[model samples]
Target: MPALCWNQRRRDFYAITTDVSTEGIRFRSSSRLSPGEDLTCSIRHIGLLEARIDRAVGEEFTVSVRGGRSALTDLARQFVALSRAQDLRPEVVRVHHRIVPKQKIVQVTLDGGLGVSGHVLNISASGVALLVEQSLEIGATIQVGRKLARVMRHFTHGVGAAFLEPFEPSAVHEAMTL
Candidate 1:
């Protein structure tokens, strides 16, 4: 399951759980974390879980679960639900979503004050992909034009952002026009 893990000393960054159980969870992180460190992980829809780093081997680490059994049970249920949902989800639905290409220059500013100029590669009601030079950390909220967006994924040229709220399709096109 997709997750975000960050120790109190750092900002939230992206991670994916390799495995999870009542006693512990194993996951891979983009950032290096030290053993014995306590961290909070916000799993999608599963809320936050307190954890202590058990060990680190390169990017993969195990964290001892600090939350109660109820939380662990809920987390396990969420994982199973998400897995089933994925199995039931259609794989080709994105083909019908229109992608409008435009080259308007825009400013992308992260919540932590990192800013970069980027070219809008395409715009849709769901999100916009930008061709940017600076590397952006996934899961960070960024300002795109007037709308707040979350960095969802990265590509060779840049990053993609999903808007905080869905916009009217035409409204997105109008806003992206320069």
Candidate 2:
């Protein structure tokens, strides 16, 4: 499963889990971490956890979870359930599923109160991909519809942005205007 791990310095890195259990988790990361280093790990759908690195060999590392056993057990179960559910569904490349909105035209507000009209290519609870004529710089803060978002990536014809505050998963729908 995909996971995000943050070092004590607050730098985040993407990781993939090789093994998981109530006691500890083993994963591979590109971030160089020493044994005994502390980390904050967030597993999708499983929430965040505090952990201490127990061992590190190349890119693989094992971390002992620091928390109540019951909480760890619950998180482990959730991970397993979600992993299984993912296997049953079609392969999903993105973190969140996107839907086309009925209203494709939207107003994108720039930082200085400048608003430009754009087309919504697709939207998810976390972010939106929009086709705009104006060139937007990556990392610029912009308002998509009514939601505040930050540009994360730029495509040939559009820009991808992550919402500053994510919407509820249930709130995303085909008929919704945002």
Return the top candidate by TM-score: 2
lDDT of each: 0.80, 0.88
Instruction: Give the per-residue lDDT digits (tens) of candidate 1, residues 1-178.
Output: 7888877688989888999787678899878888899988988767788988888899998888786677677778888887887777555355225565554788888788787897888877878888888878899888887778899999998998888986776665543552
**Residue pairs that clash (backbone atoms under 3 angstroms), model 1:** none
Angstrom error of the Cα, residue 126, model 2: value is: 0.3
Model 2, 57-148: lDDT tens digits are 99999888887677668778887788787778566368777999999999999999999999999999999999999899999999998999
Root-mean-square deviation of candidate 2: 16.7
Model 1, residue 108: distance off in Å is: 64
Model 1 lowest lDDT segment of ten: 92-101
